[model samples]
Every structure is written in structure tokens, then in C-alpha cells.
Target: MSESFTINRKEQLLEVAARLFKQRGYAATSMRDLAAELGIEAASLYHHIKSKEEILETICFELASKFSNAIAEVNDIYFNAEEKLRMAIKSHVQIITENTNQSAVFLQEWRNLSEPKLNAFMKLRDAYENGIRVILKDGMNEDVFADVDEKFASLTILSTVNWINEWYNPNGKMNAEEIAQKLCDFILGGLRKKLVTDINYKP
Candidate 1:
């Protein structure tokens, strides 16, 4: 096959693998199953991808890298903590919605990875979480946000957004931007400190 054809076949393999992994769960999806979806022999599937595990690794790491790059871009901008966080939320939701299948697999199937790859995936995952934690910490320090446990806050924000792949419908009422905005509002509402007069105080 030509070089372009080779690359296209590899991408097709990864796409099918991601969909299978999302639908069947990584532990249940066999190489034969993936090959069947592609209408090819299991042995021929190996020509495009080394193993099922390799496909899992690709999906997980590709999503991780996207998250890492997003936060890096958010960090580069000269925005207030709240604005930065809003951008991060939007970026995250967009990523999930754009690649819902791969995102689902990335979230649910990562644990199936073996020793070194699991460790590496954890590192990238932690770094991404820490990026948001830093924003929360900075917001608190700036007095723009209430003093909250950065770690817990980070987890809350991440857990809420990461599950978008579970129920987000592209053809549903809300688009990704709408969901991102609502999430940003909801999360920031909890974090934003209210002034005494703003609390509906009556003297």
C-alpha cells in the first residue's frame, strides 16, 4: 500500500478500536471483535495496529495530550483566574464533545493499561489536574474566589466535566458551548465569594 493509504488504515483502526472500546469496554473487546468491525481478518488488523493494547494507549495518550495542550494555552493567556478557568472548562468540554468516543474510552479504559503505561498515564492525568488546581489556588489567593481546598475543587470541576461523554448528546438541546457555559457558571458560582451586601442583608 502507499504511504498515505498506510496512514489512513492506521487511523481507521484506531477509530474503530475507540468505538469498540467505548461500547464494549476495554476488558471485553477482543482483537477479533475490532477486526470484525473493520471487515478484515484479525491477522490483518495486526498489520495496522500492533495489538489491542496499543490502540488503547493511543486513544488515552492522545486525549491526555489534548488536555495538556489546552491548559498550556490557557496558561499563556493573560486572563484573570476566573476567565482562565472558564476557558479551560470550554476547552475541556469541546474536546470531549468533539471526540466523544475516544474521550469515553480514555476515561473508562485507562485502567486496563499495563505497568509502565499505566504509570505514565497517571502522571499526565495528575499534571492536567494540577493545572486546574493551580488556577483554583491562584483565584483564592487573588480573593476572586472563596478559600476552598484546591485539590477538592479541582476534582469537583474535573469530575463534572469529564463525565460529559456519558450523557452528552450532540443532537440534544444543548451544544458543547452551552454546556460549557452552564458548567462554568455553576462551578464559578460556588467558588466566587459573595459580598455582604450581595447576600440580601437587611439592616
Candidate 2:
């Protein structure tokens, strides 16, 4: 086979594997199932992929790298904490929406990764969360945000945004930009310190 054909076949295998892993769960998806989906024998599937773990590893690490790179770019920009946080939210939502299937597999199946690989993945994950935590800390230190626990705030922000892959629909009413803006607004609204003058006198 030509080089182009070989590369295309490998990508197709990964795509199918991602879909199956998302729908069926990584532990439940079999190499034979992937082969059957591709209309090829199990042995043929081996030509492109060595094992199911390899496919899961590829999917998880590729997404980890994408997120790591995005956070790095956001960190380089000369912006305030709020702006950086918004950019991070937009970047993360864009990545998830653009690669919904792979994102789902990445979110759900990462725990299935083996020892050293699991440790490596966790480090990347921690770095990503820490990037957000740093932004929150900056905002609080500058008094741009309320006096909230950075760790809990970061966890809240990430938990709210990361689950977008589970329910976001590409064909839905909102695109990624709209969704990101709304999420940014929602999350930032909570973080920003409210002024006493802004409170309504209900008495």
C-alpha cells in the first residue's frame, strides 16, 4: 500500500476506536469489535493498531497534549486574570466541541490507562487544573474576585466546563463560541466580588 493509504487507514482506525470507546466504554470495547466496525478482520486491525490499550492511550494523550498546549498559549498572553480565565474557558470549550467523541473518551477512559502512563496523564491533568488555579489566585490577590478558595473555585469551574462534552450537541442551538461566552459569563459572575451599593434594598 502507498504511504498515504497507510496513514489514512491508521487514522480511520483511531476514529472508529474513539467512537466505540465513547459509546461502549473503554473496558468493554474489543479489538474484534473495532475490526467488525471497519469491515476488516481482527488481524487486519492489528496492522494499524497494536492493541486496544494503544488506541485508548493515543486518544487520551493526544487530548492531554491539546489541553496542555492551549493552557500554555493562554499563559503567554499579556492579559488580566479574568481575561485569561475567559480565554481558557473558550479554548477548552473549543477543543471539546471540535473533538467531542475523542474528548468524551479522554474524560471517561483516562483512568483505564496503565501505571506509568496513568501517572503521566495525571501530571498533565494536574498541570491543567493548576493553570486555572493560578488564574483564580491572581484574581483574588488583585481583588478582582471574591475571597474564595482557589482550589474549590478551580474545581468548580473545571467541573462545570469539562462536562460540556457529555451534553453538548454540535447540531444544537448554540455554537462553541456562544456556549463559551455564556459559560465565561456564568463562571466569572460568581467569582467577581459584588459591591454593597449594587445590592437591592428589599426592605
Candidate 3:
């Protein structure tokens, strides 16, 4: 077979693996199950990938890398904390919408990875969260955001957006960017500092 065909087949294998891993959980999915889904011999899968764990590692790391790079790109610009957070959310939404199945696997099946990869993946996950925390801290320092705990706020933001994979509809009333902007509006509403002279003042 041609090199392009080989690449395409391999991508197809990953896609099928992602679907099975998402539906059945990584540990419950076997090479035979994936091969059956693809209507290929179980042994033929070895030609494309090494093992089920390798497939899990591939899916998890690929999405993690995308997230890390998205954060890096957002930070590279001159935007303030709020703008950076908005950009980050939009980027995440776009990534999820583009790869919903893979995103599901990445989010839920990541823990199935083995030791060394697990530690490495956890480090990357922490680094990505820390990037968000840095933005939150910048906002707090600049008086753009409240003095809430950065970890709590970051987790809140990530959890809020990560749920989009469950009900995201491209043909719905809103696109990914619009959905992301609405989420930003909602999140920033809570994150923004409150003024003492604001409405319903106790004084």
C-alpha cells in the first residue's frame, strides 16, 4: 500500500479505538473488539499500532499536547487576563468540537494509561492547569479579577467548558466560538471583582 493510505488507515484505527474506549472504557476495550469494529484481523492491528495501551497513550497525549500548545499560544499574545481566558476557552471549545469522540476518550479514559506515561500525562495536565492559574493570578494582581483561589477558579473554568463535549451541537443556536463567548461571559461575571459601592450596598 501507498504511504498516504497507510497513514489514513492508521488514523482510522485511532478513531475506532477512541470510540470503543469512550463507549466501553479503556480497560474494557480489547484489541479484538477494535479489530471487529474495523472488520480486520486482530493481528493486523499490530501493523498499525503496538498495543491497546499505545492507542490510549496516543489519544490522551495528542489532546493534551493540543491543550498545552493552545495555552502557550494564548500567553504569547499581548492580551490581558480576561482576554487570554476568553481565547483559551474558545480554543478549547474548538478543539473539542473538532474531535468530540477523541476528546471524550482523552477526558475520561486517560487514567487507564500505565505508570511512566501516567506520570508524564499527569505532569502535562498539571502544567496546562497551571497556565490557567497564571492567567487568573495575573487578573487578580491587576485588579481585573477577584481574590479567589486560583486553583478553584481554574478548575471551575475547565469543568464548565469540558462539559461541552456532552451536548455540543454545531447546528444548534450557537457555534463553538459563540458558546465559548457565552461561557466566558458567565465565568468572568463571577471572577470579576465586586465594588463596595455596587448595587445593594450594605453601607
Q: In angstroms, how far off is 101's CA in candidate 2? A: 0.8
lDDT of 2 by residue, 4-110 (tens): 53558788889999999999999898888989999999989878777778898999999999999999999898478878889999999999999998999889999
lDDT of each: 0.89, 0.89, 0.88
Q: Identify the runs in model 2 with alpha carbons over 4 angstroms from their true place.
A: 1-7, 191-203
Model 3 TM-score on a 0 to 1 scale? 0.88
TM-score of each: 0.90, 0.90, 0.88
Model 1 / residue 17 / CA error / Å: 0.7
Best model number under lDDT = 1
The digit string of per-residue lDDT tens for model 1 on 131-159 reads 99999988887888888888998999999
Rank by TM-score (best first): 1, 2, 3
Candidate 2 clash total?
Answer: 0
Q: Which 10 residues in a row give candidate 2 its minimum summed lDDT?
A: 194-203
The local distance difference test score of model 1 is: 0.89
Candidate 1 vs. true structure, TM-score = 0.90
lDDT of 3 by residue, 65-181 (tens): 999999999999847877888898999999998888899988888888889999999999899999999999998888778899999989999999999987886578878878888
Collision pairs in model 2:
none
